[model samples]
Target chain A: MSEHKNHISTYKSQILVLLTLIMLTVLTVVITSVHLGPFNTAAAMLIASVKAAIVLLYFMHLKFDEKIYRFMVTLVLAIYAVVIIITFFDYLYR
Target chain B: MTGNTSTHRLPSYLEYQGKYTGILGWILSTDHKRIALLYLYSQLFFFLAGLVMGIFMKLELIAPGQQIMGPQAYNALFTVHGLTMIFLFIIPGLAASFGNFMIPIMIGAKDVAFPKLNLFSWYLFIAGAVIILIGIFSGDGPPDTGWTFYAPYSLKTNTNVVLSVFGAFVLGFSSILTGLNFIVTIHRMRAPGMGFFRMPLFIWSLYGTAWIQLLATPVVGITFLMVVADRMLDIGFFDPAKGGDPVLYQHLFWIYSHPAVYIMILPAMGAITEIIVTFSRRTVFGYKAIAMSSLAIAFVGYLVWGHHMFTSGMSETARLVFSFLTFLVAIPSAIKVFNWTATMYKGSISLEPPFWWAMAFIFIFMIGGLTGLILGSVSTDVHVHDTVFVVAHFHYIVFGGAGIAFFAALHYWYPKMFGKMYSKKIANWGLIGLFVGFNTTYMPMFFLGFMGMPRRYYDYLPQFADLNLLSTVGSWIMAASLIVVIVNLLRARKGTPEEMDDPWGGRTLEWKIESPPSLENFEEIPVIDSEPYELKSK
Candidate 1:
């Protein structure tokens, strides 16, 4: 393992990330309030996914982690995506 | 190897102390092993509680006219039976107890990535168990809304649905935390050179199971929260009048609940894979294929939840697509089954108790999975929805598939866990008794269901009396056999000699260590320069 102190992210960057997440959550709530027809739900989820990704990548340290961890995360997300797509298609086409 | 090394000598459970050293040590300890044992003890308690409920259910069905309990009592009995068995017994029985105990050891780690979180999960599990048990005794009665806790009935039921759903919510958190811990442990804590493919199939299955637990569990958490809101706050998520769709409740429920089946069975499949390879003295046929198929099943399992919603007014096209995906999910399951059997094809095979249970799991699960195909078909599912066939199908999968696999794993690893040898003669008899009793109890339900007998009924028509009687009789035999197996294993615990390392000539890393392994598992993690089941070289 490399020197732990050197590898750790700075406090300022952490604070910036936290602020961005807070801003995104606020934006999500505000956007939900605006009537965007069917697009409203989709928009909220999209924004939520982005915020979640940010937390997972930075706060959870997936960005700094090994490639295998990234692979595992990616694989699980890919599978989740497949499930949602297939279920949505079945629901819609039917 | 140092022949005179003190560590070479085996350590008994009493002498084995890594973190906790005494009786109080176990009760309040946070060590993963102690937590696992705590889970084992509590799961046994829940298993027996569910068993008693099952016996009462059978007794009520025996005489046809509510002989043992009232209609309300009967409903509560079956409902608690389902809830306890699913939430308390089946879900945690294999994964939490054995998974917690074995995963770290199997991966050659000192402990789980989150030992404190493991203990916290156990506490949460016990808390949830107590809440559900409180509901059972409250006299207002247990939740009669079924294990699914489906709405309208769940919200409208006079029984303590709030406590039950809340208990389920807490249990879901316990499950989620366990999943999160396992994922991180598997990802980050594997011993120095243990690569993804080098990990045991059990770890692979758990990795898959943890994902299901993380992704799918939250949905059920939200669903149960919605149920609580409906019941307590009257928020009307499932209220047809309040513009909420009851069908939406099911869609949300099975979204987690269906993959929840995979959560229960996938680890059992992993355990069976390990047992089959060990007993047969062969590498698992298509190791990579079996491992990949595990991930495939977990992925596809999520899409097929709609198969459960087919008869609930889902569109026919949706049903058709779901039916196809459900069948596709079976392909990977079939691949696993084929790989296991082919591993056993020409290799040395033992008829040990674990092997017998594995064989039985295969036979029973084959029937269960095939019948599941019949149910997955929308048209046939419509006929059998809520019938005893659905009950029989799932019992075969859950009880036969997961339940028997758990027993098999217990038998296979008992020597390692307790460092003593159970009587194989008794085990053989116990195995036969269980197999016979299991079939006798469940096989008739298929016919009863085919004859249009609906499930969850307190009192059935007289036409169903004879088969019910036979089923009840079989349950008694099963209970006796199960008791005998536990006794036989416990009997070996006092003063018996410690078992040999590689007692079964297994090729896995776990067997490479001493029985009742030391606190740190390995003094030096062995470099994995060979295949997982390379028996010939050994």
Candidate 2:
């Protein structure tokens, strides 16, 4: 448990992560304005995922947590993804 | 152990005066035992409220035409009944009461990882209940939207949907917090050598349920917020005229609502596993299989929510996919049912009230589970979409499965929690009435539904009169038995404190402690050395 404390992010690193997230948000908005057709939604979601990844790693400290937390998150996200795909089955066919 | 011997036996949790005195002590204090009791009292209050509403609804349908109340009154009765039962009573029912009481102790810990958060969730629960009361009473009329609060009508209704939707949102938060607290506590607070597999099956059930609560509750919380916004803020979330897709609301609603069923039943199933293993005086067969199946149900439960929306103009492709997935979730449940039956195959079996309730759970849950398959089939569901059949199926599962298991576990742990033993004879009599009357009240609904009788109608055809009258009589017997059970338990609570630490000869860590355990559960944190349910050798 003491070893986990050593892995904590420094203030400067935390600031850098925050700045990167803000930059990604700006990029997402700018890309949405360009209208990449179907790819616009994909691009926004992709960039949003990157920003969320940064936040989850740095701010939430999942990076410093145990392997079990990572496994649980991945399992949850997988289920959510499957539900979305199944829901889209209706939209696509109808 | 001698180092702390004097402080250990000085006061049980009930007698130990915390920082505050009397009611504030319970309300403000963070003691898990007292908090569990708080939940028990409030849940009982709401359960009776829900039960009375159900009886009224049944009475209205007794003779078929204008019995006691108007159709509008019947609508309010069922709406409040559904809300009170699902949100107020059963959803948080077993988990809030027994889960809080047993989880930390079974894990060999002093309290949950976040004791303050546990107490706070209780407050949130109370706040949610208060908001719901305001929603029903202060409005122009009671929310007639049913507990589902299905859209277009929900938004368009003059009744106070806003307060009720917000109340559900708050209750969802309370549930999420409870789940989050359990997950962290189970991960971080297990005693010295208590491995995950070595922990009791009840904890494993809680682990699975906690995941569902954490992951799935947020969707319904957001969905409720959207409904409130659509009603109040003109956001057009589920309003079809405002370009909002109503089916989307159901998809979002069922996404959480379906797994929420697992959240309700998993702990009950887990409790039945504990009771069966204890009464049979044997090691649990297929421990990993039963534990893993809980996770499987929770996992597959998410995929199967689409079955509920099958007749709502969903695509044939999605409907077929959902039906298949619904059947898939049953495999894991069947695995548990089979495992429990096999555990009692060659063991020494004891006949107690808890054992009887557990057996009833198995029998009725089988009926419930089998009927679920019927509802899951797209073609069959099209025939009986909102009929009394769907109502009967879920009552068997939620009421028979979860509700009866709750009573079984309650009686099994009564001696432990309150340090008194209820009369075996009276309890058995009560069980007889409950079993007989329960079947009588609900079994006819399947036939009525097969006869094409739709549900939620205050006035029914004269053809349905005889069965409806029989159902009302059955409900009276059921209500009387419930009162008998409650009075029997109350009588037991007034007796002397039980001396047997392991009254039932059980092997769980909780059974190793004194009845009505002390404020800090253990004098010394126990070292884990053997299996959770190892029987004592004669």
Candidate 3:
């Protein structure tokens, strides 16, 4: 177990990430009031995914980690996206 | 003894006393080898229980009317049999038992990245098994939805679906933790000079399996929770009255269950690869291809889950796409089979017990895999969807693939694990009986299924009687053979060890150490210089 220099995030960056998350949450609620039929679920999911990525990158310290960690995150998200799309093949066609 | 400077032989993992003694030394210890034995014992016990349930079910299907059990009893029997075999035995069978024992040593590491977490996973495994058993014996009745736990029926069944689903949820957690432990261990624990490609093929297969365990298991775990929520709170996740789609539930279930099959078989494939290379006295052909193909199988396996849902009312487009993906997976799987075959080409082949078991695995698994393509096709699958053909295909794949490989790995590693050699002549008899009896039991089912016999039924048509009777007789032979195999291994437990350490001239790191390895596997981890399984003559 070798000790290395740690990347400490500035309060400004943390506060900015927090505010963006809050703004996205409000926008999610605001968008639900205006119905876009099928696009409503799509819109909300897109925003939620963005929020998740933000939390993963900043809150989870993945931003300061090795490149392999980021690659793994992308791989997991890719798998999840593929599952949802395959599932929607049934729903969209039906 | 080779790398270590210590003169006197320290205690082998079997006799090493920890914080506590006796059974406590086993159950409470964090050692990976001891934990593997714990899983082996528990798996053996549950496997016997499942085997008994299967025998009773086969007996019920023998003539036409109920032999000794009623319709409802037969339903419960098949349900519990699938549950016990799938969850408690085969799913964790090879990976938990042999993977735990071999992975760290094969990679030249002392222990897994998280030793305590490994022990905790075993405890969770037992807890989950206990909860499932309670759900069986103490409920309103055993779950009759079968192992797939298809929705709508599962939602309304009075037979304790909630408890069983919850128990499965817990078991999924254990799988996830063990998978996590292996991933971290393999990533961080390989000895110096060992690159990713230099590691043994068994480690590669475990790596692929661990990913499936970590990523795919949680999907089913959440799905099981939703089933429980539907029963307890009327949430209607799959309830038709509440506008929840039953097909959605099928989608969710197979999303995990399909990849779960890979979880069962990949480690088995890895074990077979080792046995094939060792007995052939040759280097594995297409080493990089075999390693990459494992990852390919894992990745593609996740996409083809919808093949299980084709007749379950999924859309035509989804079925078509899923069928294509299913065929794609066959490519990588075929790569492995060809590689194993090529490894044995013109080499100094040793007809050992483990090699015979590996041979049986290939032959049986090929039948299973090819029959699987028949089911993977949308048109043919629609015909044999719920028929005995599907059941036969499943048993061939899961039982023949993973089950046979488990025995292969046990025979290959037994001398190292327990420092005792099982009877060669008896082992040969057991394999013949198993192969002959297995084919007799399942081969007729394929014909019976093609002739239109539905599975999970207590009674059948008068015309179906002869084949069903033949299948039942085969089950009796298989059961007797299984007894012979287990008793032979058990008798070896008290026998003397061989003087040599590298009994099979194995090329892996585990073969380089003492038979029945020390407390921490290596005194000082040996540095690697060549590819794993590099034959000296070659």
- Candidate that would win on DockQ: 3
User: What is the CAPRI rating of model 3's predicted complex?
Assistant: high
Instruction: Between candidates 1 and 2, name the one with more favorable DockQ.
Output: 2
lDDT of 1 by residue, B1-538 (tens): 1111235664533366555457866766666776788888788888888888888888788857768778887788889999999999998868898898889878877789998899899989999988888888885788887898877789898899888888889999999999999989998888766789888999999999999999999889999999989877988989989977787788889989999999999999999999999899878899999999999998889988888888777777878888888989988999999999899999889777788879988999998999998799888998988999999999999998998888888888877776678898998898889888988888889988988999998788889989989998998988889888878877887756655566888777777777776656676765666567777635
Rank ordering of all candidates by DockQ, starting from the highest: 3, 2, 1
Which pairs of residues have clashing backbones in candidate 2?
A: none
lDDT of 1 at A65: 80
Where does model 3 exceed 4 Å of error? Answer: A1-3, B1-8
Error of 3 at B49 (Å): 0.6
Per-prediction DockQ scores? 0.41, 0.77, 0.83
lDDT of 1 by residue, A2-94 (tens): 443324879998999999999998999899789987567668877888888898998888888877779878876876667656555544554
Which candidate number has the best lDDT? 3
In candidate 1, stretches whose alpha carbon ends up further than 4 angstroms from where it belongs are: A1-40, A47-94, B1-7, B10-13, B17-21
Chain A TM-score by candidate, in order: 0.79, 0.75, 0.90
For model 2, what is the error of residue B513's alpha carbon versus the real structure, in angstroms, after optimal superposition?
0.7
